[model samples]
Target: MAMITWITDDGRHRQAEVNDGSNLMLAATFEDVPGIDGDCGGCLSCATCHVVVDAAWAERVGGPGDHETVLLDTTASPRQPHSRLSCQIISRPELDGLVLHVPAEAW
Candidate 1:
């Protein structure tokens, strides 16, 4: 399993052990991480799971896909250079220590 951390706007950190291939949006919601609302159930339809990858982990986590970029534009929070849709990220060994910053609102 990969260990991931989600920090809220107020700095509340929620960590979880997620199995490989698990969609990040699902795992965060299952962990009861505030500010993450996977309204589309990881279908990539909703941008409720928007998050900003910590700068230290941005290159490692990579950027959003073309389609995800379009949706990122509609997120409730102002998009960051590292903004990504949690649904687009999957848990994997390489991302074991991934840290994502949750927006103040999920809309």
Candidate 2:
């Protein structure tokens, strides 16, 4: 299983384990972490699951696609260069251990 660590705006940390094919949003939702709402059930329609991946993992994760980029524009939090909509990210064997941080809010 892949491990995903979540850091809150105020410096709180929460971690979730992802199965080989699990996406970051689903893993976070399953773990009941506070920041990710995942209201669209991993459909990528909502930006509630927005997160900022750690800089070290940024290149490994890559940037969002056009569709995901558009959605990130609607996020409640201010968009950043490293912003990502967690729902669009699918965890694979290669992403065995990923760490993401939640922004202050998600609209």
Choose the strongest candidate by lDDT: 1
Backbone clashes counted, model 1: 0
Worst 10 residues of 1 by lDDT: 98-107
lDDT, candidate 1, 52-104, per-residue tens = 99999999888999999999999999998999999899888999999999999
Error of 1 at 41 (Å): 0.8
1-107 in candidate 2: lDDT tens per residue? 77788888888888767887778888888888788899988887989999998888899899999999999899999999899999878887667667888998955
Residue 5 of model 1, lDDT score = 95
Assess the local accuracy of residue 77 in candidate 1 as a C-alpha lDDT between 0 and 100. 90
What C-alpha lDDT values do all the predictions have? 0.92, 0.86
RMSD of each: 0.7, 1.1
TM-score of every candidate: 0.97, 0.93
